[model samples]
Target: MLGSIPDLLRLLAVPVFGWAAYRDIETRRVPNRTWAPLAVLGVVLLLWDTYAVVTGPTSGRLFFVQVAISLGFVAPLAYGFWLIGGFGGADAKAFMLVAVLFPAYPTYYLQTTALPLEPSLVGVFSLTILSNTVLAGVVYPLGVAAGNLVRGRFSWAMFLGKPVAVERLPEEYGRLLEDADGFTRSGLDLDALRMYLQWRGASLSELRAAPDAHRNPDSLPADPNPPGDGSVVTDGGVPASGSPDQFGTAGTADPWGAERFLDDVEGSAYGTDPETLRAGLELLADADEVWVSPGIPFLVPMFVGLVAALVYGDVLYALLSALGLA
Candidate 1:
């Protein structure tokens, strides 16, 4: 019964992750608060599981070792991915939570068969989930390539992005292929634009209506909805400002509101910098169309990976085994 408690508790993560995945798709942001309760619960349950294993028979010591390995491997792996820009802060947090919540595989039986059709050889359940996430993530790029092929658009960039009219760009999610300097892989993030618009309580139509009116900071008026005690909610659902300190001394008079937005948000957080925003805005003003990469909402694949890991264990391991490589 004690063992079953942890297994059952782990199931709660499914719905939480599902909700997070939905939010990631809709807004591309998940609140930090979303993970707070889960973090607390995960720690408490981990401690309880630790006590159960330690006090139980010596044979159960292997579970303890598996937990240690899962923590040691997954924590650093998740952190490393975040450090290198391979993973978002939320993605890293989710992976770490998985490490804490289910460091060892949770057994589930269905009639005559045991679940987790293939278990991780290293006994690291978190690692299995990570592998499954990567495998699931590959499908998006392939679909993009296929779509581009059907449209008769053949280019290396087709796999990364699709061309959209500049007028429709503001409504779209993703980054621009053209920057201040010209075409580049590291495009300007649309989220920054959304954040700027939200901070100023302005709309894209207003920007398009009077492009010159909001172009120069010196000519711009005082912010109608300046960042203060209240937080500005961006299109992505991330708070534009939690505190005044985040904006530094960026004047609110800037018509583009680019200065304050860029000042407060980190480059890594949005995959854009001040120069990129400035240049991208210029491109928007001049260009008729631009290439935009609709980045995959990673949480979707992550949720899929979690479900796969729970059912199939390590998908990559199974594939390699079938290929006779493992």
Candidate 2:
């Protein structure tokens, strides 16, 4: 089971790529010095797969075929993203790298064939996808939660050294917030809200240029309701949605929305999506939050289904029929 049939390289991609991201995030620079070695390593692996799985023997051909199959599956989705401006070049490249490596992992049953794909090869791929999706979901909210702590409870748990929203006040507004009690019984004036929105808009713009812009000092504001706590509560005053956040976070807000609270941020108003709103609110309740890119959550089903389909072509076909996609 170990003879050159895929083991080391397949598993190495995640850690290698993850470490690179972590380092880049820390340094704000993914130097060519670091990427050079990774590029060489990737090339070597491609050649290894080509020789061992493409030209060595029957199973080898199957391996190469699996790689092709999985890549084929993502073509449509990739195209869709390309058209929608959802992914930058790097995003597409990262996904392609994953595809070239993982290919078809789970071995499917073909000879026996009692019931179509009675055993799906959806184990490893599915688990990985599920875990990734959950992680992304949690991390975004945690960022917003950290923001909430600052905006409501005065905590600095989410500071990443990135730019914080700079209020574009009329030369004197910053002095006002310095008084410790900026928005008390006086009721937050429209000017302040306008300033907040403008700054928020600028922040969103900066974020699009560099997704990691708000890495440091993330904070959400408290709700602007009469009580003015950074909490989203129902009529009874119970916490409305899960609170405490660092920050899903994608939708444009370049245009600012109708009321800019619970609306679309489409090139404006933080691209309106309730889930995005929930995350943004958790970050800064009173201010606007918008997404820079438009990447949807990475669905595990995409990977797992592709692997199973390639390994056991018939099984994949049956799956499609069951879902009526065929």
Candidate 3:
């Protein structure tokens, strides 16, 4: 009965994490509603499972101790990652949920043959999941580096990211890879740009008003929305269905229909107001290209790590064994 409950929870968690990852990829935000219920259900299932198998004083004590260690250790570690910006809020919460739901590997899902590692290490499912996640995450950068080399885009930052036209920047999930630089600028500090824009009195609205001069003409996305017919594509590429606005028409406040393209550029952490947009425009005025890092949502890798942990057991143990160090 104890075995069946965790196994069932594992089945439930996969789809939930899968959906969360999908949502994160599209919108870069996962609703708290999605996680809250999963968290509650995980706790209830874990408690019931623990109760079902607490046969006597010794076994009950062992179960309680494991629970304490899982909560005490994993919660702090996840919270630390969040505080340090190593993981996002959603990612941290997901880790805590996994620690509660499957503090150890679900043995019933595995083969009859014993796991290669010592039983103690196999039991800490959250640790194994974290290890697997980190290992999987490493592949992305390596792949990016290899692709950059193949395309002759080699540079100091090529491994980290490539340049995209400012207008082509994805509003949903991209970060300015650069701090700040411009010929008219004395400092590369983001705050300095903010102050400069304040001094100049350049507003995002004014920049939006004159899109042709500031925005890259060559980088403009081809208007998929027909004039006065189809849904208007906003700056974030979200369709303004049935709205009056249309792309690539003349005499509109934004002629290029490029308002949505600069949404993130305007509201970046560098600054969220008009000054940030002015700063971005200044940087663009001095350079043809700007580097932007692909904003990877952490939930994507966590879900992958969970599946990997289940199928492969402990990633570190497997690696050590292969290296003849275990």
Candidate 4:
């Protein structure tokens, strides 16, 4: 009965992760509230497992060791990934939660065969999930490459992004491949435009319809505390419109309200600076089409990883072992 508790707890993660994957696909944002109840439950489960280990046989101490390794190692690793921008806030939080909830692999039976077909030597369940996630994530790029080949659109950039019409850019998610300098891996993020549109309470079409009205500094409400950094403001005391230079001057056309959006919105414009946003907007306004990378919805692979971890144990470990490397 005590052992069954861990299995049940692990099972509970399946639906939660599935739901999170769905939400990630629909909207890139996931609310912090989504993890609250799960975090509370994980803590309770940890306490229960700790108590069970303390009173149980000496061999059960290994379970405690696994928990320690997960909390001490995987938790910090997840945080570091977030800090380095390798993982989003929600992705990092998801990994941390997995570390807490599944410190050690839970035992289960599949008819005649026992579950976790192959277990990791280190026995940290969250680490196994991460490894599986990485292996599963490779499929997306392979799929993209295959589609590009099938369509006879051959380019080195095929693996990264595909051509997208500039007018349809606002409707798409992901980053643009072309910038002021042309062809960049770390291009402008579309979310910044979405956030700007949301803040202005207007659509991209509305901005494009009356470019002058949106671009004029006096047309919109006055900013009480304008940025004093001089990044958005020009020497002429007006907001810098995207000029012909890298950072455009007020004389340049801004049909997308990029400069006004940067000036009005506080802080870095959705992970990009004011100048880059203006430049990227200028490129978008002038270009007929551009390449855009539809970033992988990481939660889908995470969900797959969770399932694979539970069923197959550490897939990479198994593969390495098969290759005689482990």
C-alpha RMSD of each candidate structure in angstroms = 5.4, 16.6, 9.3, 7.0
- Best first by lDDT, ranked: 1, 4, 3, 2
lDDT per residue for candidate 1 within 1-326, as digits (tens), equals 23378787888899999999998887777899999988998899889888887787666767878788778888888989999998888899998998888788887878767767799777778878888999999988889888989999876578888888976765677888766566678777776666566555555556667777557554333433432222223343423322223222234544454665555543332666666766777777767778788899889999999999988789999899999999
**111, model 3: CA deviation in Å?**
8.2
Per-residue alpha-carbon lDDT of model 4 for 301-326, expressed as tens digits? Answer: 99999999887889999899889999
Model 4 clash number: 3
Quote model 4's TM-score: 0.83
Best model number under TM-score: 4
True lDDT of residue 58, candidate 3 = 55
Native-referenced Cα lDDT, model 4:
0.74
lDDT of predicted model 1: 0.74
- Tens digit of lDDT per residue, candidate 2, span 1-326? 12233434454544555554554333222344543454555556667767765565476655555555556654344555756755433434445555544454434233554212333344223223323433444455456557556666342322221113432221111111111222221222222333333333333234334434332223222232222212111232222222323332224432222233332222222123433332332333344321111112233223333333333434533456699986
**Whole-model lDDT values for every prediction:** 0.74, 0.37, 0.58, 0.74
Indicate the worst ten consecutive residues by lDDT in candidate 1.
240-249
Instruction: Kindly state the number of residue pairs that clash in model 1.
Output: 0
Assess every candidate by TM-score.
0.81, 0.37, 0.68, 0.83
Error of 1 at 288 (Å): 3.0
lDDT of 2 at 67: 56
In candidate 2, position 8 carries an lDDT of 43
